[model samples]
Target: MKDVEDNGLKNDAFLAAAASELEQMVEQICERIGTPLHETTELQRQVLAAFGFGAVYSITHRDRLTEPQAHALSIRMLIKPFNYSEQQAVDFVDDLIRVASNEEVHPLMNTIIHRGINGHVQFAQEDYEAMGRNIQEILAAVQQ
Candidate 1:
């Protein structure tokens, strides 16, 4: 019983920390993107939803999850609504992760760090025109 109680306390702490980190990141993203949180487009909101899930999961399991494990989890969340095939999903996720830490992932992604639970995001560049190129490509590919 004591062990279980202790574990519960740890989980609670983990969740609180994750929420705080996510909130701060969201604020930063909104600031960088020059769009308030409420004005986010439907697509942007979808991405945020995935990030939210990934953030919580990664934070809670930070000690146990490998880098690949955390990356895969975020990819799964981001790709969930797309209904891509298993192989296609893996390939796309790989491509996304390959560009995760850099400015190439997606322009909006540039504003928000791709680190699932670490919450360490940096401003890649201040060029708004260059930011959404990746997302535009992804959307174009999906439409076809």
Candidate 2:
């Protein structure tokens, strides 16, 4: 089997597609928060970006992750991206939800608000190199 990275053309194409999917996911998330991507406030855009990365990271690391789990992970993942402390992450989630509530995005946040973001996210310590290696291996296996 060819090495996933060695197959430069296919790998690059896959990464491009993955990135585009991530961007679309972020756009959808921002819309759900009641703000169009282009119209989002600077802070909202940052939050949405963090949320998008968080969603992708969770999906990559967890098996069969639910939306609520991904939402919870997004809140936890917001800390470093936003330079927030744990409590601040919770506060940020509350603030985001309040703003979204006004825009009817509150319902999406409501179900996960009480889920708690205080727990440790193992994903925080994941090794990206290992993840890349694993994705390559999976791709190579599937292409066989």
The collision pairs in model 2 are: none
Instruction: Please report the candidate that would top lDDT against the real structure.
Output: 1
Candidate 1 lDDT over 37-137, as tens digits, reads 57866666555543444353445365464565455544544444334456766775565554444565565543333333333312123332332343334
For candidate 2, lDDT tens digit of each residue in 53-114? 43444453544444454445546555533345788667766665564345365543332322
Regions more than 4 Å wrong, model 1: 51-61, 65-144
Highest TM-score scorer:
1
| Alpha-carbon RMSD of each model | 8.9, 17.1
lDDT of each: 0.48, 0.44
| Model 2 misplaced stretches (Cα beyond 4 Å) | 1-6, 59-144
**Residue 133 lDDT (model 1):** 40
